[model samples]
Target chain A: MVLRVLRSMIGLLLFVQVSVASAVLDIEIIGAGEHQIPIAIVPFGGDDLLAKTINAVVMGDLQRSGLFRPVDLAGKAPHELSEVSYPDWQARGADALVIGSVALQANGRIEARFRLLDVVKQAELSGQAVSANGDQVRAVGHRVADLIYEKLTGDKGVFGTRIAYVNRQGKKFSLIVADSDGYNEQTVLAQNEPIMSPAWSPDGSHLAYVSFETGHAVVYVQSLYTNQRTVLADFHGSNSAPAWSPDGKQMAVVLTRDGSSQIYLVRPDGSGLRRITFSGVIDTEPNFSPDGQSLLFTSDRGGTAQIYSVPAGGGTEQRVTFGEGNNFSPRYSPDGKGFVYTHFINGKFYIAVQDIQNGQVEILTAGGWEKKPSFAPNGKLILFASEARGRGILATVSSDGRVQQHMFTQSGDAREPVWGPHL
Target chain B: MKKLVICVLLVNLLAACASEKPKEVAAAAPETPAAKETVAAEPAAVAVDPLNDPANILAKRSVYFPFDVSAVQDADKPIVLAHGKYLNEHPSRKIRVEGNCDERGSNEYNLALGQRRAESVKKMLVLGGAKASQIETVSYGEEKPKATGHDEASWSQNRRSDIKY
Candidate 1:
């Protein structure tokens, strides 16, 4: 009877010690405010090649969001959960920590096990294991981002998507597809004439762009895999600014064979040539809304350059922009919440966003001459053109005005970038 | 007879004095700014009819080139002189220039070509005596077909520059 009583007392003492350790862990993190939930990514444990690759990718993903600042692991590493000194983490200002290890398991399979902790809540957020080889190290890193994103943003993350853009090298123009990080660039079309606009089809299997190969701007849709190309329209006038429909069956472009520069719609098979607008002035640069209900474009019918929207089937157009200077290139957000456009006023151009409801213009950047704004698939990042010093370069900003990333084509000039659909 | 001869001489001297006095009065008058303004506004106004309502209500402004070239036209001498005179006289009148194409090219190419046309006009207004700040230009390209049908008569109308008040 006495032994049983002593055993229960010992168990209670052990529980108390564990609770005390957790309390210390919570108190040691920085800015783990009421809103800022803490997480922990423990030092990656593995050998040189595998460890270096995984750690670098994981760190790169977290740092890009601008919402996350990674904690460095050094020789003062704790041997186990018991040896994890809460005071040291508190000094380092880590609200949370992730302890993970990567190694080869049975059957020649590589496995990575990761554990998440809410240092302040004194609880575990998540502990997960993902199986992948070295070839998939980059993808696994994205999965880690997804895991962290859901915990922090309360929304699923889409980090697996790609971006396609027009790259100009010397006098040569090419349609280049690359990973969003500006890596693994692949050329789909290499042509001498300038490629104006490159838009991804709804299914992402094909791309539609304007090429000046035939001495006039013509819309051509081509499959990325097989390189099968078809000219959508090479009409009598300007066949320019091709925007794909949500279903990818038809494309909208600007043609003036009738009288003036007016917007027209053509099928993927180049059968129908229907006029969508008769502005009696210039109307071009049409972009389809994600739901395919309306088309937005830049028109001078409003007395000056302004953005206007018309139904996809054609109807009364409404003025969407009402600022002093001219606005061009209205690319709607994937979620249909807002749009990004090139705002020109005061002898300068900057990217501005106009909410579909209030029509309020929010200037996304200042001082830089920005044009051809494209939204990231997640609707959290914006890519646009910024001229730095003497030349033009590509720049990005997070939707919330937090993150900014510089991207470019090594081929010289990377212009008119459109982030592909969520992968 | 001697008295009659003296009377005739006196009448002849009086006529000579009257003619010389009027000639001297005309020579003494200085050229007024209004005269200069009228002189300046006349040539531009003569280029287009004033009663054409919208077209000539404000003398139809145009972008000028030295010869027949599509390059951003430079106002050699006369157009600038006319634009300056009109601006100085009609200070409150805001002028808008609508550029046109001769219907020789496709619609999109003509639009760009017409824009270059209007830009030439804007540059002239700025360089000429007119205030660079007051003028605005729009390129109708080949859309506002000034003339219907496919002949030179229609093409001439299509290539014209209109002055809008």
Candidate 2:
């Protein structure tokens, strides 16, 4: 009950968070030192209210990065990136300057133009114009951030990717997908019954989800590009969990055709069936390790649910998580150093990251009812579902806990977001 | 509450209104051979309501689970069984079990774990004599949840198979 009240409060806060315009803008500042970049984002070139909002969101984003500090909005720096006047910002201890313009375009599109200027280096680091639909303005901000991130880190950004989730609507549920920045959502599947798991193929071109539409739990892989789908498994006794093989040719799932649920490898075409788990009871959730040499799953052989690792070819198993909680749903990072899974410990469920090489684990959330954290292909961000304001919402936090943002809207309750592998 | 009430009323009225309209069309058009067939099939098409008929709903369905866990303690069981029986008798109706978890373990492990929970319920229902082929199961592991609250109650609610009938 207290949680419900807290969610209402946070729901109001989140409404304000997404609705309120930001005062500080994120400006790129390339400098010589590893020290934080001091930035001055002057009033944007177009639309006073929108510029302010953009500036504030960018400012908050950078602040959360812990690598930049915003200069005062009142600082008198009458310089724009169009003409080089680095001395004015440099004199104000500003390491960089950001300037932008927003224009409402035809066909309900928006054009956001941005330039990152370095005060000390006296150079323009990057420039780009992004076009987005009216419903995608917030997503445009994330794309702008992606550009800034690429300018700084030289790595691609996942800001354009989307997360798929499931939300219970009374006795039924809806499978929803939304942008990483939480905008332009569409319901892919809505069943008055229930929809459970949703997994993105490694290529990000298809989705594998579990649905009870057939009066039983079954795995179906749908090609997002074509809308054509094939049933991967529908075993008689129990058929669930469709793990897309990294190669996309096959999937490792669990089937209870023998009257007991066991891990099985089945061809994507529904041709082959091979059982790997010999356990007499409860061995499930088989995820492919990055190397494809091991499978991470859960088994009750230990008398309770715990994370276990076994050879990909099917062999003896070893327990990996012995912490206070019983663990399930282990997803190995693409890089394969460790794994991320749900931890049920002390009667609380949270997304935790564990290093397989060493027995190290850490919680990756600030607070408030978080579950089902999946990593972006870059492995730098974790996306999970949470309840805020009496509705399920998706939360994105930097994997290192450096930046956190909560996304929920009145359109519908969003839950169980799985980050697509690199797009 | 209002929505549910409206849905039930609308479905009932539509079904009832549909029954008379088809018969009138069939009787008047029976002179045409196509009309005769249409008239002949009116009675067959208006058999029973999906929700109101128990024998129809209990005809061809069951639930599944993993190996040893047979208690049906997972919260989704009660909800799924209702759907299972609904489809069992419907005969033409079909659905799938979407199993999930609370996001605590490995993806592969959770997949199986979710499957076990789903299959466990399925097996119990089969022994109780629900049709085997009428039910299919899918493991979503921790990839999906019915409730998003991070607390134990919410997680427990999420860690089971969802009935889609």
Strongest candidate by lDDT: 2
**lDDT of each residue in A1-423, candidate 1, tens digit only:** 235323422322221111110101000111211233333456557644555566655655555555677665555544245556666666777777766667776665456666666666556677776655444454555566657666767765555455777766666776776555555466777777667678888766777887767644577888765668898877644566778898888789876566556888888778888999987677888899989999998887866667899999899999989857777788898889799988766656778888998877788676456778888777877877665544445677666655666654443566667777643
Quick one: best DockQ, which candidate?
2
Could you list the CA RMSD of all candidates, in the order they appear? 19.5, 14.5
> lDDT tens digits, residues A178-236, model 2?
55555545566667655666888776667787776765567888765555788888766
The local distance difference test score of each candidate is 0.61, 0.62
- Output the TM-score of candidate 2: 0.67
Summarize candidate 1's per-residue lDDT along B34-136 as a digit string, tens digits: 3332322322233342224232212224433221133443222233334544564456767766667764432333454565465566565565457755665
